[model samples]
Target: MDEDTPRLLADTNPLPETIDARLAQQLTFLIEIDRLKTVLRQSPLAAADRRENDAEHSWHLGLMVAILAEYADENVDIGHTIELVLIHDLVEIYAGDTPLYDAGKGLDQREREAAAAGTLFGLLPADQAARFRALWDEFEARQTPEARFAKAVDRLQPLLLNWMARGGTWRTPGVTADDIRARKAVIGDASAALWAAGQELIDEGERRGWSRPGSASIT
Candidate 1:
C-alpha cells in the first residue's frame, strides 16, 4: 500500500484496561506510526525485488551508523547519531518519501515535512511531543556533528542501494551522473572519506551505463 497521506484511524484493538493516560497517548503514537511501513520508497531492495519502505530505510541507517561510524570525520557519539537517523524520517509517515532525483517535488519538501512533523509528533503527550519535534528539527538543521553524520549516512545508504540494484534510481530518465553527484554529494558534509569513495561509485555507475548520461532537463 503506497499511502501518500497518512490515514487518521484507530487501531482495531482497544487500549489495555490498566493503561494510564500518558501510556495510552504514547501507545497511540506508536500505533499511528505503523503506517510508515506502508510508505514505499524509490530505492529497490538489493536482495529483494521490491522497493523498501520508510521503516526499513530507517532501520538500515541505524545499522549503517554502527558499521560506518569509524569513517565519520568527527568523533561522534554513535548512539546519538543513530537516534538522529532513526528519528529523521518518521515525518515521512505523513509527507511520504520524496525521491532524491525528483527536483520539482524537492522544492516544497521542507514545508511538506515540517507540517508532517507537526501533525505526527503532536500525537504524543505534550512533553514527549516537544522533545521528538526538537530531535527532528536537529536532524534537519544538520548543525551538530551527529546530525551531519546522520545526514551523510542517510544519503550514503541510498547511493549504495542504487549501486547494488544496478542503477536503481540512476536508471530514471534525465537523472544524469552529475545529477546524482549534485544531490548525493551532501555526504561530504560529514565524511570526506565516505564522499571520496561515493564519488568513485557515482563515476563508475555513469561509466558502466548504470546512470543516464547527458544533461537532460530534470526540472
Candidate 2:
C-alpha cells in the first residue's frame, strides 16, 4: 500500500492491523459510500426545505420494501427486494442523480450508471464486487420479481413525496401530470394496489393544479 493509504485510514476510522484484505476492502467500500450522502436528488423532503440525497433515498426505499411488501402483486423475497433497493442508487454517488423528466440527462443515464457501478462496486472484494454488481444489474433489468417490486417501490417513492409536498416536482415548469403518469405507469406492473394509490395521488395533483395537463395515460 502507498504511504498515503495508512494516513488516509487514520484520518477516518482507524482499524486494527489484524484486518484482512477482504475486511479492508469491505471497509473501504463502506467509507466510499459516504460520498453518496452529498449527491442531491430532485424529490424534496416533505418537512424539510432542501432536497433529499441519494443515501436518504436508498434508505427510504429499503424501509418502503419492509413496510409495503405485502402490497406487491406477486409474492417476493423481502430481503432480496430490500437488497435491490439499497443497491440501486449506489451508482448515483459517481453518476449523479438523473431527474425523471430530464430527457437529455436520461438519454445517457444507462451508460453513465454502468461506468459508475463498476467504479463503486469494484471497491469491494472480488466475490462481493460480483454479488453487488449482480444486484445492481438485476435492479436495472427489472426482470426478476424482487427487482420488479423494488423498482415499483423506487418509482412510487418520489411520487408519494411529490404528492405529500404538494406539487414538489410537479410544480416545475413544463412538468405536467400526464407526463408523470406516462413515466410512472410502470408502478402498476409490480403492485396494482400501490399503483392504485399512486394513481389517486397523480389525479388529485392534476385536479388541484399541483401538476399541469398533458396527453398520456397511467397503467
Model number with the top TM-score = 1
Tens-digit lDDT string for candidate 2 (80-146): 9999999989888778899988877888999989988887788788999999999999999999999
Cα deviation of 60 in candidate 2 (Å)?
0.8
TM-score of 2: 0.91
lDDT, residue 74, candidate 1: 91
Candidate 2, residue 203: how far the Cα is off, in Å: 0.4
lDDT of 2 at 42: 94
Give the poorly placed runs of model 2, Cα more than 4 Å off.
1-18, 216-219
Native-to-model Cα distance after best TM-score fit, residue 139 in candidate 2, in Å = 0.4
Q: Weakest 10 consecutive residues, lDDT, candidate 2?
A: 1-10
TM-score of 1: 0.93
- How many clashes in each candidate? 0, 0
| lDDT values for all models | 0.89, 0.87
